[model samples]
Target: MKRGWCFLLLWLLTPAWALAAELTGVRSRADAGNVRLVLDLSAPVKYKIFSLKNPYRLVVDIESTHTSKALSMPTTGMVKSVRAGKQQGGDLRVVFDLSSQVTPTSFLLKPQGAAGDRLVLDLGASTTPVKATTRSAGHQPQSKPKPQRSVVTRSVRDQPQRSVVIVIDPGHGGVDPGARGKNGVREKDVVLGISKELARLINKQPGMRAVLTRSDDRFIELSARRRMASKQHADLFLSIHANSFTNSKVRGSAVYALSQKGASSAAARALADKENAADLLGGVDLRGKPDLIKSVLMDLSQNATQESSLALAEKVLNGLSGVNKIHRNHVQTAGFVVLKSTSVPSVLVETAFISNPGEEKVLGSKKGQRKLASAIFKGVQDFVELDMALRLANAPSRPEISYEVRPGDTLSQVAQRYQVSLSRLRSVNSLRGDRLLVGKKLRIPTVAGI
Candidate 1:
């Protein structure tokens, strides 16, 4: 963490374009289950949106905005999913399309700090045959199906769409204080607070849900975290952590991916070792399993998912840069144990440095945490939007990378063969060990660390 003065100075030096821009409208539509966003801004806003290979998500960045009203988000026809709010002091959005072909509508309302202005929209109802989209214009169409709501005559599964499940992992809790600041603030607490906030925001949206790896203050094995996401059949995973440095003069946010074997830094490998060690805390044995097999599988899996993850990570990095300095402008890849969930796209977010006294105090503050969490939420939304756009525009799905299960194939051996870390392989394929079933299929996650 850097001094308060540095933050102040950075703010002073920021390009005037970023400081004064404001978000106005962001309308979305669904076409064949794909969602497309058209942002109506007061001015030409310069922004970027991409995905991170780890903790896969879509991220968006905009100059700034003062949203003071309830935003109009439709859940009707083409719009089967929607999420919108403030993040990092800017307008945040999250949306899911049951199919492509969406129509967008937008309007603005006056400012009201607490409730904000009312941006009203009616998502005409999806053209798909889902029960929720069957309502006629005679009645106010329900945005989505809530717990208390009744199911229409149509069955949800009949619509034929994949559910998107997101798992949130809050870093450093219980016995691990993680990084501690001179002001006595703990990184664990700050990240937990932000995670909870993000979960709350995600839960409020339709077609999206969140699960926390550890809901309470307790220690959890890193392997278990990945397993949790696998058990939940999650679509994405996110690990949250606060950073620290020997000198209390550095501050910024960062995101990381899994490293390819021989491509990871020594520091990243060490961190991976520590994180993987958490699995041993639960007493998982590893006396010579198929390490190479697991590695090969991850390489194949990542071949299909890496592009999206990288895009999302880049978007997040850009979005975070809008709110604060970035530890690294590019997305980094390492052998992080927590990110070893092979099925779900995963990423680790280092929110800020706790070693800096000023940053520590700010992070401990409710306002600071809220701001940080908001930025992240918005970045995720942006990533989602980009994905929807690609789908609607007929963008190609990632090509699946494949690996063969050879006789006597071990996880480590396979990993070494593919030049990917063993943990990374296990994560992508949801493998318990180096054990391989002959003639089985596997998805490899990474070819090298970036």
Candidate 2:
């Protein structure tokens, strides 16, 4: 981790003229099973709204506009708080913090008698059919302190660490279908299908395990994706995507590394521009971020990360060229949001062009998806093994043992039985609760060189 991470490369301020419309006022009305929020605008505009789960939130994004200072956000009728902000490229981002799951419907109304143009939103809890998978709102997970006991360990030499961890991100999901093809192929679905295959192959390797940013079709903000990768301290972050173009004739597989100097090619620039809008399409609040920006650390990390990214891009490109048509003989560069991990070396792979009719058919088929997955799996495994082989040569190999809990045994007792710290057991296995379920298998970590 780099020090002095106070500088964050975020959106810059826009000028006055760029702020096109004036947000005049906001009002609301309430009734049983329904609540309406009306925003008076100086002009009619285009807008979109989407709901996010795992802490239910409703987000609204409007066209070029400025927020109204006099606009009052009412917390009545299932609304928690309404936060409005200026987004990059002269757009207005409004986020409604919700108390529970609510179906949101928004539409524009023409100026009527005694009223200006209005963007009316209806958020009704009862009208929305709650899904079984919805996590309870404000449900805080409790982690009890484990009972303490003495833990003994057999003396051993330096222990080798765990396998190299990779984070795989299948771009755009849920409401954001990503780029769509004429044949009904969706970018989100295609990438996800390929990513799942890659994960299976990576896990089969001796020293590699892959963690997905999202295991299912769900929306995860670009910021949260990188945050998850950093939290895991992943060795690499690979984002799988399908390319698209308005022309519909362009088709090929390409690999990209991040570039602070802008895009290397016009197509790369356009694709990055489209992909960067994913947060907006997915209804993510731009203002949600860390408190401090670390400029010096960010710069240092970017330089190193880009270097490693370029190397992986080269290797991956080679593997991909054999399986698919090469978009560019050399790796390309772009500002991909999901590839912006400071600590992890990241690369974004454009498997093929979804906009191209012929390529779309190939990518949509299971055979095509598996071929792409196998190419990516081989590339990543080759690169990671070579990189870590020298480092692991001197370290003792870590052998994970699975222990099934018996009756009358606590998690602490299990840790003691394995001569490992309780925290180590939990961290390695991603345990949340201290409660032990008999016959549940727990992966025990070795203490020699952990």
Q: Output the number of the lDDT-best candidate.
A: 2
TM-score: which candidate is best? 2
Worst 10 residues of 2 by lDDT: 148-157
Model 2 stretches astray by more than 4 angstroms = 1-159, 285-302, 391-450
lDDT of each: 0.57, 0.71
Model 2 C-alpha lDDT per residue in residues 107-207, reported as the tens digit of each score: 56666688877777676663333221111112112233221112111111113445677888899998899989999999899999999889889867655
Model 2 TM-score, all chains together = 0.53
Q: Which lDDT tens digits does candidate 1 get at residues 1-450?
A: 579989999999996546654455556655654444544444333333322221222234333544334546576344444334443335344333433322222233333344332333322333433222122112222343122123222222233233345678898677766778888888778988988888777656544556777766777766567766765556667888887878799888888766655324564555555544544445554324447326524451354466556556766676678777887778887767566555445778878878877778768988888888778877776665445333422322223357788778877866644334688888889998778998877775421121
Output the worst ten-in-a-row residue range by lDDT, candidate 1. Answer: 132-141
Stretches of candidate 1 above 4 Å error?
Answer: 1-162, 262-301, 388-450
